[model samples]
Target: MMTVDYRTLFADVHRRPGSYGLDGSYGQAVAFIMGCDAGNAWGLLVGFPEWLAMKAGGGANLVWSALVLRIAFPGPTVVTAAETLDQQHDEHAVGALFGLLDEFLADRKGSRGAAAIVSSYLDWQRLRREQNS
Candidate 1:
């Protein structure tokens, strides 16, 4: 099986610049995308809010997002979790980001992850509306 070491990879990514002129490392990009301090980045794997902040652009995006996880589940299960999150909340913008983790994070494929995230976002939107009502 192919395994990714998140901390190491994050360290490397954070050290370089993005092709689109994103300055800083993987952590920086995540922090920028999330509007929170990337810090060590391990917390992101555990928190759904951070995941809600970003979308999947491609495999490169998934590599960084999933590798940060302390754990990784199969693509389908992670997508399911995102859908379940939707039942309680809505975060459609980043719907494409559910693909993720370490044992602390979920390992989802990019496409499925995006579906799960979109579902969660839809739920989030519903919750928001309910709250406003």
Candidate 2:
């Protein structure tokens, strides 16, 4: 599996809208999709159904949610990346996202699955960004 650079993912997601099945102008579409994903993650964390959660129920939900929130509201909705080395204390959104990843890894008893999940997210983020960009 390959590693994912989240910064690149954000740039992609920020740039692409059509590739994600969104309509409207590029910015509008990307923003809409970003909000939808973020809302779904938020919903999952708050006890929404697994199906509705969109990868929110499992251990990876935390990471998924963090990325969603980051896309939806960038630049200090929580602790900006510059603020903390340890992801746990950055911001609520970031914590929720990584929290899911952590939980998933812990439940599985290792970082193997966590790495895959991260990789997949990175790939998806990159693809979306490229399509839109």
Candidate 3:
């Protein structure tokens, strides 16, 4: 079994997007991260989406990538779903994505209340699961 140090991986991706086939495309970067999360067996990045949504003042309706994109380019920049998709590949958005991701990882590293946020997100997930069951 292999473990992923997502913070280091994100840094690598940010440093050389071309090596990852991202080509400096925000959409592709988002896709790559999402794929990594999906395949993560060690539970790394757990509660990240919830944390991001909370940070972005968004609900769970939008995914983590959408939350990042929204935070990076708010208002009319992503007013509609169509426009949101269009901006996903924007160069500016790509820069913002990596910057925000760095912030996110730093928060995870040692920021005050980082555990509280993840704990709160876990509680939310537990409540949702209980409600559904």
lDDT string, candidate 1, 51-105, tens digits: 4333321122243444233222234333322223332222321222322322213
* lDDT for residue 90 in candidate 3, whole number 0-100: 72
Return the lDDT, model 1, position 121.
52
Rank order (by lDDT, best first): 3, 2, 1
Q: Which 10-residue span in candidate 1 carries the lowest summed lDDT? A: 87-96
Top lDDT prediction, candidate number: 3
State every prediction's TM-score relative to the real structure.
Answer: 0.28, 0.24, 0.68
Alpha carbon deviation, residue 125, candidate 3 (Å): 12
Off by over 4 Å in 1: 1-11, 16-50, 53-112
Q: Which stretches of candidate 3 lie over 4 Å from their true place?
A: 1-4, 76-89, 111-115, 120-133
lDDT of 3 by residue, 1-133 (tens): 7866777888899889989887667768877877886786625556667777766655567767777777766775552122455544476666777777777766776653557667877677677779889
Off-target runs (Cα >4 Å) in candidate 2 are: 1-78, 81-101, 106-112
For residue 89, give model 1's deviation from the true position in Å: 30
**How many collisions per candidate?**
35, 7, 0
Best by TM-score: 3
Candidate 1 vs candidate 2: which has greater lDDT?
A: 2
Q: Which has the better TM-score: candidate 2, or candidate 3?
A: 3
